[model samples]
Target: MDVEYLHHGVPLADYQLTKADRRRQDEAAQVHEWVQRQLAKAPPWSEERWERMRQLLGPPVPPWELQRWQLRLYCGHVVEATRSRERPRPDGGVCDEERCPECGMDPAVIVAFEPPANNHSPKSSRFARRPPSDRRSKAELVAENNALRAELKSLRGQA
Candidate 1:
């Protein structure tokens, strides 16, 4: 049998075919022929296939679903928020912001209660004997502060 050889659509001489090169060329030709046969055998798109695809895909989802209520930030800015599929809706319907986008104030550090002064305490001895309000060591506090600063820096960089 006689065969014409081509490399990237350009004609090649028979002398160009080394033993390894011939094996590679044969493998490539077999792969191309297999792909062509597979493509020819593939079923054509039909209404049945389309319906099956839709069924598998389920309902179309919107980019975001608007919540029934709005989010009230610590900065007093009211913004419309989207409801997450993974998380359940808030009990109050509205969600409170941890960090205000408008004023850039983080509500996470807000102090809910302050320890009464030594003299102002009804039980002075009990209050005096009580442990420090913040039990964290100086090193721990510094580490926490550094971590928070780093996080803030990264967040600012992203913005």
Candidate 2:
């Protein structure tokens, strides 16, 4: 029998991986399998974890006392007017009113939430249709205009 020289602690002929290398590869495979299983598992939302998440997000706002409400659909879509029922037209035909324009579902079936804004009055949809803002009343705007005119007049007189 003839023996070949060894290079880098490995035999030149019939080269084979060492026992330590085989054990290391097996350990690496086990670690990779464990990581894959962990990734596949869903997040465990225990009561404590849920409570912590709640703490991060403040308490829910009170629902508006409006007959109509803006709804956030389960599919993450939002639409205005939730409770408005369709009415018949003068020609004795069904009105072309739709509860939800996006999903074409009735207001009752869609998941609804009060719009997260308080600028609009709860009793009326007219204000809700308008943008949410602290707009000045017509009287206030007139008063401001008059005040500005008077100031301009006074400045001109002084000049």
Candidate 3:
């Protein structure tokens, strides 16, 4: 038997990822774990339960997971991070003016809330549909629309 070494997209080899890709993958894993935990808490889903879960998990970070940005500070208060314009200093050096607007920390400390490895469900989905607990059902809405149309017809006839 002969040994072959392949470098370009070959199988049985570790692939390299860029910094951005690695960051995105890590973020996705964290968000997935958080979502799974939240979902588990609201099992046998309902609209109210789903909404509560959404509030607890926050909004989806977008493009990958369903979670919100929870900015934690050293003071133990939760806040949001925003981009700010650079300010010019006396030495003509530019500084990042971005900070926690709530606490006004020059360099806002970021605290990530990553769920533990065992908290995630391997068979879960990234997105979930709303449960059948909304106030108005589709059939009810359709019947109400028909009733309104009939009432409008009667009013037009009287006019």
Candidate 4:
């Protein structure tokens, strides 16, 4: 008379045991099972830990404000085009429109023109180009710094 081991009300031979199952006979399987149990019983993320992570990551970035424009395509189809407020169109506005999908036309006329509600005023120096900067190499910068220091020392000595 043979007595079969029972697994969850089923015969142990018929029941399938995975590597991580506590019922598995192998040493590696037993270790895997212990590890899974340890993980399950592990402590959850603490508020301090969460705060530290947030500090390391810094502040969350604000979502981009998108502007939608109604455009009349050359194919007589009206469609909407969306763009971020930070981006400027060819006309220096945020009303860049895409071509008509139906007719495959390149340019489309804007149906409704609404200026972007930008929170910050446009910079006056936006179009004004700065005078070309004197490009000096690293070696030139070090030489200039040394010369300036020498001149300062000479001036102090003269005083």
Candidate 5:
């Protein structure tokens, strides 16, 4: 099969990637290996584990899978790439500066959060803490309201 090849700024199959490109590739491969090792620590990762990894990585997985995996396992977290200002239009009628480069239509925004992987607190722990003093059960509140109303009615009749 005919093949087209490009390397760095150079072209053709003979051309090789530049020093920078090789460095980047190496780093990426290292990360991939790291991720595999992390996974290997446990038994074969299940589909759910993969999905959780994806969520932690966020959309568009980063070049370093190992770092991403570490972030996932440490605590459920996602990192967003930094966004820069957009460019202006040619005619000057519309501009890209106010809008996002990724979506093009919406303004750029960053959101980051880490949620606990599981609510694994013990069932016995629940009873350890006292409920709020101000809180009353629905039934108790309703009954109290009925009694008040009855008392008010009796007072009105006496008047």
Candidate 6:
């Protein structure tokens, strides 16, 4: 791949980010936050464990709050255990599936990927369309259920 295609006219060393570039970075951060919020609300169910999750990740955390200091915590155990005599991903590094930090389950079934960040308030399709995160937290689920019920009643009235 040609590096010039990516850098453009700016010299490799003189790559000072412009205001527009900064704004784009900000936008990306916002979108990522939105995605995380959605995931937190509607964590994927584990068919094997048959449990909501081993533990809750607590209230939503915006990436902006963490800044770059934030480290990508891979799932439980190293992908490989120690470099050993000869191993591809020595020292239990991240695996392909990316399991949990606590439990060694590929994709974790709990932790999920963040979505493209945006400044505008992010709305989950599940909630907007059918409230996929109905029963995440008890309080929120109740609120969602109530809203759904109200909508159903209103629709019935029209009918």
Question: Model 5, which residues run further than 4 Å from truth?
Answer: 1-10, 45-159
Q: What would the per-residue lDDT of candidate 2 be over residues 16-89, giving only the tens digit for each residue? A: 44565456445545665687799789686799998999999987643442233344433335555423222111
For residues 52-109, what per-residue lDDT tens digits would candidate 4 score against the true structure? 9999999754333443433343234655555443444322353333456877644443
Global lDDT of model 6? 0.36
Please give the lDDT score for candidate 5. 0.36
Best by lDDT: 4
Provide the TM-score for each candidate, comma-separated. Answer: 0.21, 0.23, 0.26, 0.24, 0.23, 0.26
Clashes of each: 0, 0, 2, 0, 0, 17
Off by over 4 Å in 2: 1-68, 73-77, 82-98, 106-110, 122-154
Candidate 6 residues 22-99, lDDT tens each?
Answer: 464455456656877898999667775553343354555544222111112232132211111122221123322333
Quickly count the clashes in candidate 6.
17
Candidate 5: residue 132 lDDT (0-100): 69
**Model 5 weakest 10-residue run by lDDT:** 66-75
The lDDT of each candidate is 0.43, 0.44, 0.42, 0.46, 0.36, 0.36
Least well predicted 10-residue stretch by lDDT in candidate 1: 1-10
* Candidate 3 per-residue lDDT over residues 54-134, each given as its tens digit: 899986455323222333433334443321112111111232112556766444333322222232221233343334564
Candidate 4, residue 157: how far the Cα is off, in Å: 0.3
lDDT of 3 at 63: 35
Please give the distance, in angstroms, between residue 36's alpha carbon in candidate 5 and its true position after superposition.
1.5
Q: Which stretches of candidate 3 lie over 4 Å from their true place?
A: 1-72, 75-79, 82-107, 110-131, 135-138
